[model samples]
Target: MAEKRTGARKSSSDGDDGASSRKAPSKKAPSRKTPAKRAAPKAEAPRRATATQVAARAAQQLLELTGKEAEGVTGLGRADDGWTVEVEVVEVRRIPNTTDVLALYEVTTDDHGDLMGYRRLRRYTRGTPGGE
Candidate 1:
């Protein structure tokens, strides 16, 4: 009769167990070349200012220059490099509210709403008509 094995048995698919002190050569698949990825386009910036922004900028610049608060924005226009704005500023306060003096200033700013320069066009009392 044949004798039975008592320990682990070896199989045909089993790899080297280091008992034989031998190694098997490794195999690798061929590498594939891929195309490079493209970068996303950059966003563009605005070249002009909005009506609200223009008005606010004009009033702010006027107050800074004259040290008096701005009454309001009277006019706004777009120029080659920036904007043309007309701002009304309180120049003098009188005992009679109706006699208070006001000044109209023309302001210029860059495309980014930065003040470039300004000049006072005329002055008038609060009760005056058409600033004349």
Candidate 2:
């Protein structure tokens, strides 16, 4: 899949001057595709992790994709990027499952806990506030 990357600016000010700033949303055009045979790969990979390392790595990976730190999130899992963490977030629309998937954001940082880049991949209700 091709990634459409675009940068957006979010104002940090909470001032309300009765003004609006918006742009027309861009729509992606769908293209026809041919169905391909579905078959599993016959190759296997070797193990390279211990139990403790696995859990710690999972938590770190979650912090990168979703902005939420591990402090407010739980139920981490393996995602395409590295991990998927669930959290109770208000930014997401409060729907049941499809809409309210408050997954932890992933962010890159240095030795210090300074945030670099982050984005959310998916949302789930597991381990959310009130235990979802």
Give stretches of model 1 more than 4 Å off.
1-47
Best by lDDT: 1
TM-score for each candidate, following the candidate numbering = 0.65, 0.26
| Counted clashes in each candidate structure | 0, 9
Instruction: Give the distance in Å from residue 127's predicted Cα in candidate 2 to where it truly belongs.
Output: 7.0
Off by over 4 Å in 2: 1-71, 75-88, 93-100, 125-132
How does each model score on lDDT? 0.79, 0.44
Candidate 2 backbone overlaps, count: 9
| Model 2, residue pairs in steric clash | 64-106, 64-107, 65-105, 65-106, 66-104, 66-105, 66-106, 67-105, 101-123
Per-residue CA lDDT of candidate 2, range 17-40, in tens? Answer: 222343447687785553553354
Clashes of 1: 0
Supply the TM-score for candidate 1.
0.65
What TM-score, to 2 decimals, does candidate 2 have? 0.26
After TM-score superposition, the amount by which residue 63's alpha carbon in candidate 2 deviates from its true location, in angstroms, is: 12
